[model samples]
Target: MSVIYGLLTISILVALVFLIVFIFSVKSGQYDDSYTPSVRMLFDDELVKDDSKKSSTQEQKQD
Candidate 1:
């Protein structure tokens, strides 16, 4: 009854606060890197060194 109205108003206020914060951040440049984040997973940070090639050469020398 009365409690429900209070809870609803509090929730709405909280939601509005979050929306305002998000809007301010967007305007400030927090989300400027819109493209790199989406494509970051497609590229590797560093090339993986091929250890097998080195190990095979070492084995040939030892034999």
Candidate 2:
């Protein structure tokens, strides 16, 4: 019985801590980039292609 009470109290404290941290993160613009992440993958391939082109050009110049 006493052990159960202790466990319950600990769990509640842990939950409250997590809730507070989440609230702080929200207020601090942690989630502000809501759109970029979703669309970022769409542009990733283009970026990789551009990078490879630039590297190849640089290698040609060096050689």
lDDT per model, in order?
0.84, 0.98
Model 1 vs truth, CA RMSD: 6.8
The Cα error of candidate 2 at residue 47, in Å, is: 20
Scanning candidate 2 in windows of ten residues, the lowest lDDT window is 29-38
Local error of candidate 1 at 36, Å? 3.1
Clashing pairs in 1: none
Model 1 C-alpha lDDT versus the unseen true structure? 0.84
Q: Write the per-residue lDDT of candidate 1 for residues 2-59, one digit (tens) a residue.
A: 9999999999999999999999999999989889877876654432334666778899
- What tens digits encode model 2's per-residue C-alpha lDDT throughout 1-63? 999999999999999999999999999999898898889989999999999999999999999
Q: After superposition, how far is residue 5 of candidate 2 from its true place, in Å?
A: 0.3
In candidate 2, how many Å is residue 4 off? 0.4
TM-score of each: 0.54, 0.54
Candidate 2 colliding pairs: none
